[model samples]
Target: MSIQPVSRERHAHLRWKGFSSFAFAASTTLAPLAAAEISQAALALPLAFIERDGHWSMAAVLGLMPGQNLYVDAGGVWLGRYIPAALRGYPFLIGARADSEPPPCIDASSGLVTPGEGEPFFDEAGSLSPTVTQVMRFLEQTAQSEATLVDACETLASFAVLEA
Candidate 1:
């Protein structure tokens, strides 16, 4: 199958309604950083690139968010080496999955975001998206600079798929 260029302009704001201690921190902090909400529209065609059964024949939601940046390692791990001071207080992973798998979960008292609910999730990629692979590729190209958290956040924002 031909690889279709994915658009990365679909910005969305995910109102995390799940329960978590981290929720409080995100709401208090991220709520202010967010600019707009893509809750009313779908991702652009380019960013809408999907492959199910070797073709672009699938139904999904693509959303976005503007807040703390996130980054994942080349080996599907969140590197917690150099987190920004602004986001250090929060539970942002360096290279980790965004699903509720335990250590990655938001503290009930802090905040909570679930895949397809508050956070982004790919049924095929789990909490990761095709963009994750793209980010990994980008990381591969530029291995000098430590992976930027904003890179992951921006990419994740471009692929935040909402549920029907």
Candidate 2:
């Protein structure tokens, strides 16, 4: 998959179509959760703290093993009331860079980015459209919350309240 940063200069011509299925997340066993959504997500999904490269974050446990997600059915539909923020934003992601804040990116291969179709990322004036603006804001907020989530999880681990 070609994952590239989104910018008015590069992605201005691209259009974004909404995710049609949870198929993209069908193989994911753990979906990252922000601190704000932890309570709601835990109501329906088993919550667990996951560690990557020694960084901790809370996540929703979707299955017992890797490449399996019990919440997503054979049809790629998610059978849950609260979709994790990570999975909710399909094709769009916040990418981390050295000494910089995360940038919003797109999974170009997800078939969600198209030319002359769906909602435009930018308007004719080369500015973010309303739809893209809302999505970008949500992604940025989620990224910001990730730090708090990590701190909280680390605190939980320190208290011997969480298991990776």
User: What is the overall TM-score of model 1 with all chains considered together?
Assistant: 0.20
Query: Across residues 1-164, which tens digit of lDDT does each residue of candidate 2 receive?
Result: 68998898888877989998998888899888888888898888998778966977878999899999998999988898889998777788877798987777889889888887899888898877888778878988887787889988789888888775
lDDT at 137, model 2: 85
Error of 2 at 101 (Å): 4.2
Error of 1 at 146 (Å): 8.1
CA displacement after TM-score superposition, residue 61 of candidate 2 (Å): 0.6
The TM-score values for the models, in the order shown, are 0.20, 0.90
Best by lDDT: 2
Tens digits of lDDT, candidate 1, 24-73: 22322121110121121123211232333332212112123443323333
lDDT of each: 0.29, 0.85
Return model 1's CA RMSD, one decimal.
20.2
Error of 1 at 152 (Å): 26
